[model samples]
Target: MHMVIYALVEASTKDEALAAGKTVFDRLVGTDAHSCAVFDYYVTFEEEDTSVAGKARWGDLPTAVPVDSDDGEELLDRGWEATKEEFERNLERVREALDEFSNEEIMRDEDLARHAFHQVGAYDGPMVFLYTEHASGIRHRGQLDRILEESENPWIVPADVHF
Candidate 1:
């Protein structure tokens, strides 16, 4: 998800860039206030290197969607629904924005001039951070742990199960 977002916004315009950032924030808030609550927003830079060679290429920034939970069951259904929508909508929007940028006459720094007229596989800029998505639903895993610690339910911890 991080790689895709960065790649999609590799050489985007000002207005489009702001829109992309806002979309990420909206998704995070809607998903789990706990996780999105930790992040600031999608980080990006207007003036950057669009080169395609070197170890510091733009696609290497942090992309984890940070999340925390005090009560998992409280947001189970709502969190799942929002998470799904975030992934789908953002993916499509990013692709569309990149495609639109590809048509413009983009100019880059001297080091990146060689590839200015072409669409390389990934970003060669200074920064390219993408949004994060929750892997395990917000509180489910922790709920499992809490059940293990607070309950004597045999099914929660199988008799034959060993870690």
Candidate 2:
């Protein structure tokens, strides 16, 4: 089974964020390691309100996406169309749920951890939250910390990573 790990990568632009994410991924999982890649990367601009709103909007979307198996078979039993329709119908509710949280609450590691499938690093605000696919646990966090520390840019980017 595939597992996900999250990190806060400091970078100015989305391209820089993605590049940092790739570096982190390669360091943690290694170039010749198991099947792994940067699953998602988000870059937040300087404005706090804008960043929070953007994050809230992103938080409103559904996590599951339609996918096909290696044999060209549909994996989702309900099929993509039905699932998408359901997602669209429930978007308002999702937004409402997100609306309940304050900006500070939304960026809290404790709150974020509550929704994650695995352990995650701390988030401050308006930085890249890099999601990657790899085998990792609590211990991997130390390695991540080291990697971030060694870099010239600030280490931690604060944002929620939804599974």
Candidate 3:
């Protein structure tokens, strides 16, 4: 089973955003980590102010920003301990930015994405949008299947697992 939680946290300042992220990270770690695991992995959030950088405007080209990956390997290899730590750190940074900016706003309209993408992008708003592509559970399930296929572990590989 895959669970995806995307939220628009309200914070008065950039610091508050950081705090909120920390809180979220803690909450998710509890349920996501497997009890049998010796260590936990964490997901970290990274964000930057696009105010002066200029939002991605339609017909406007993207600057030559080097692409980077937070995790060097696939999700299945991100051990539990590392996953938890990374997640908590990401949230804290976002919360800090929230506290500093004093913007307790959330993108109220879901259609705002369409507006921002096609027409007026990123309104003069005090809100910050956050997203997490959680593939850990899916990858874990796949790994579990591989382990079972290779040997006789009581854990049955779910039919839903493609790999």
Candidate 4:
């Protein structure tokens, strides 16, 4: 899948931001707009530093470190095999945190977790990279951070997932 990101570029006006964003977007997706959603609007998205990306680059996604030369789906699957219990526990926590939401929302989130397991195929791993298609998961960043912190090999939420 194509990447989804909200970037900050130096600009003096809205038009400038859109122009810069489009330029970056075009370069990222190779001018092939059909790959991912593209939008331009006024928004203030909170960004945090990624461990894999390092503290200096706050908004960018983390890069993947190939595991024994394996990358993509294989890496993710292997990680899952290695840490299935921890991953499941993390999901249980998500469900608990999301209890205020409707059953549909919770199920959707569970599905998102599963999809992340399947498709979070690349990352800088000492721990498996946990990711989701839903940017809204950013709200629970602290939970992810805590989970990672407590782990022997932490699961990182990648800033980006290659391939």
Q: Which candidate is the best by TM-score?
A: 2
* By TM-score: ranked, best first: 2, 1, 4, 3
* TM-score, candidate number 3: 0.21
In candidate 2, stretches whose alpha carbon ends up further than 4 angstroms from where it belongs are: 32-163
Worst 10 residues of 1 by lDDT: 154-163
Model 2 pairs whose backbones collide: 123-158, 124-158
**Local accuracy by lDDT, each model:** 0.30, 0.34, 0.28, 0.35
Candidate 3 local lDDT, 1-163, one digit each (tens) = 2111222233444345444544443433443353222113222223233322222111222111111112211222323333344445544554544554433332332423323332222111111112212112312235444433553211100000000
lDDT of 1 by residue, 20-87 (tens): 44444444334445543322222333314444311133433222211122222222333334434554
Q: What is the lDDT of candidate 1?
A: 0.30
Badly placed stretches (over 4 Å) of model 4 are: 1-3, 32-163
What tens-digit string does per-residue lDDT give for candidate 2 at 34-102?
Answer: 644332333232224544432444432212211122211221222223333433444444454466766
TM-score of 2: 0.24
Model 1, residue pairs in steric clash: 35-67, 65-132
What C-alpha root-mean-square deviation, in Å, does candidate 4 show against the real structure?
15.2
Put the candidates in lDDT order, highest first.
4, 2, 1, 3
Please tell me which model should have the higher lDDT, number 1 or number 2.
2
- Residue pairs clashing in model 4 are 61-159, 62-159, 64-123
The worst-scoring run of ten residues by lDDT in candidate 4 lies at 37-46
